[model samples]
Target: MNKIRIGVLSTARIGRTKVIPGMQRAKRCEVTAICSRNEEAARRAAEELNIPKAYGSYAKLLADPDIDAVYIPLPNHLHVEWTLKAMAKGKHVLCEKPMGLNDGEVNRLINATALDPGVKVMEAFMYRFHPQWVETKRLVDQGAIGKPTSIQSFFSYFNADPDNIRNKADMGGGGLMDIGCYQVSLSRLLFNAQPRRAFGWMDKDPEFGTDRTFSGMLDFGGRLSTFTCSTQLAPYQRVNVLGEKGRIEIIIPFNAPPDAPTEILLQQNGETRTITFDACDQYTLQADAFAEAVLEDKPVPISIMDTFANQHTVDALFKSAQSDHWENC
Candidate 1:
């Protein structure tokens, strides 16, 4: 097939406003359907996005034989359940980040995929597909920053709405799972290895009973990475990669604007250089990459093993927070 048929599993804001639109623009995939628990909402989103079909329930959408793949933009708690269901139905999956709540959930997915090895599954970490990030990784590998040793990141936004899924702790809602995962994922990416140990500090919101702010450190033997994420703070995000001889700073790392140019600063020998990337949707790149993997019968860009490793690191950080000491990853 020249183009893979994709079905979106929800009317989540991220799907309607970001992922679906980007997938629609991808060359290797077509978003043919969208579904929601509420029939009216499903129909509304389908109509707005010009999708061919809308289903009232997720199972109904998954049952559609026409769909070769499914994108799960569901909440944190629902990720593993729906992904396993999709795999059972012989559908490729592109599930959103923080693939599962903990190591146990991740292991369940790992074991299930082992049984159905043909079905490709990937965690949606779209930032890594952006040209800026691609270039950053290339430069790091080429030793633009000699002997990379440390990374620091900060991501935060103000959201006090109790009704929002992010504030619902039972549903696996929290700043750490929502945004802090990015820090862990990128650290492993740049370090080209997993951290040996992790340490974390968290401040929970009394009303929400969810972590509103979180800070963590990952020790990759001689290298170190630190990050702070918040759900109740001024909107901001930036990442700095420091090496023995140079440093790289990402001005707006995570939520890169699709229409505007993005820039990164590279400093060396008392001079700073700005590297700019043209306007492009990382989501589109990510969708096309996953579609190519599905069409070519190749491994997905971010493997399930990598997803499990990231979750393992996150689990370690949470353990460290509770134990008030370092935890092995």
Candidate 2:
């Protein structure tokens, strides 16, 4: 099989530290190029990552005819712009999470992809591709958890740096946009339903103009989900799914260790057992999934429509926080 030549759109930390290397490990994915705003920085990354080519600007990378796909790890606000541009250039795209700043941007992203149905576009939610989660879904489907009725998630990391982009409101910085997004996506996926309404409360950072702490509840018809996502709390994360018969718990739900084995706690019939997953790189899994989609003409796993629903729920949560009432999603 011919390898998919993938271009790294930016030298973002996630790209440099995790995703690019994972792409290199993925089957049929070649990390052929790296791009950054600074030519020197791009060259430095190219040398460090052992990429053959480097481009000083995103446009240059897009213009390269050799690139079959692009992994975009740009900031939250730039996701829509670069993804649209990359897809327009006939390049399949795997863009990082919170694919847009709001529902409107996601709608625009959907429209752009609709205009070019042949091009594959996916939101990079790496955790979804992990075997642990896959097994968890299988268990749920097989009624190990009976009928899943509710979910609760917590994702938090203490970050008070005012200079960080995650603290900048204009850059789409905030706990909700960063980590809460995962909670929302997880809830929807586990429930297999979109939220009908949402309620939220947030505490803003005075200096950063971003939410330091955010908590929200999502109503999925007969089921309900709640989450707390924070950038000012001690680092920890978990997801719990409750059903009529039993409950399922993901210990390191979101930021799972790439090199270490992980397990899920299953409690049913008054007994508890741990299901272990061998150490696996979800980033690599994500890359290979995208490569498979592009190379074999299959659909991208996480569709823009799903992203729109996630972002729409996020938007509704924020709106609910402002109005101090449940907001329709």
Candidate 3:
């Protein structure tokens, strides 16, 4: 197929506002169908997004032979279950991150993928596909940053709504699972290695029983990464990658605006330069990249094994927070 015929698993806000629109812009993707448990909701979204098909239940969407792949934007807890089901029906999957609740859940998905070798499964970390990040990785690898040693990131937003999925612990809600996973993923991406150990501190919401504020440190042997994420705080996000001779700072790391230009700062030898990237949707890039991989039978940009490692580190950080000590990743 010239373009991968895609099906979206839900009418989730992220899918409706960001991922679906972005995928619609991709040349290699055709968002053919959308489904939600509520038939009316599915119809409304399908009409709004101009999708050709709508289904009240996920099973109906999965059974459609025309859909070459499925994008799962369900809550954290439902990610692995629906992803596995889609794969079982011979549909490729692009799942939203923190792909599983814990390492064991991630492992189960991993083993399932191994059994279904023909299918492609990838965790959606769209920020990695942004041009600014693409440029940052290039600069780091080319010695523009002079052997990166430390990475720091902060992501936060104020959301106290008890009804929101992100505030419900049973649905895998919290600052860490929702936003902190980006920090963990990017640290590994930049360091090009797994952390030896992890240390974490968290403040749980009394009523919600979910971590509202969390800070973690990853010891990457010689280098280190630290981050703080919060569900109740002023909204802000930034990432700084430091090296012996230089540093790179991302102004808006996550939730980058697709319609506006992005900027990054590079500092070296008492000089700083602002690198500007034209407005482009990372989601489109990500969708097209995944479509290319599926069409060409090539390995995905981010593997399930990489997802496992990221979750393992997150799991270790959680353990460290509870034990109040360093835990091996």
TM-score of every candidate: 0.99, 0.99, 0.99
Off by over 4 Å in 2: none
Q: What does candidate 3's lDDT look like per residue over 1-329, in tens digits?
A: 79999999999999999999999999998999999999999999999999999999999999999999999999999999999899999999999998999999999988998898789999999999999999999999999989999999999999999999999999999999999999999999999999999999999999999999999999999899999999999999999999999999999999999999999999999899999999999999999999998999999999999999999999999999999999999
lDDT of 1 by residue, 1-329 (tens): 89999999999999999999899999999999999999999999999999999999999999999999999999999999999999999999999998899989999999998999899999999999999899889989999999999999999999999999999999899999999999999999999999999999999999999899999999999999999999999999999999988999999898998999999999999899999999999999999999999999999999999999999999999999999999999
Model 3, TM vs. native: 0.99
Q: Record all residue pairs in model 2 with backbone atoms less than 3 Å apart, i.e. clashing.
A: none
Better model by lDDT, 1 or 3? 3
What tens-digit string does per-residue lDDT give for candidate 2 at 25-46? 9887999999999999999999
Cα deviation of 250 in candidate 1 (Å)? 0.7
Which candidate achieves the best lDDT against the true structure? 3
Better of 1 and 2 by TM-score: 1
* Candidate 3 runs further than 4 Å off: none
| Root-mean-square deviation of candidate 2 | 0.8
> Comparing candidate 1 with candidate 2, which one achieves the higher lDDT?
1
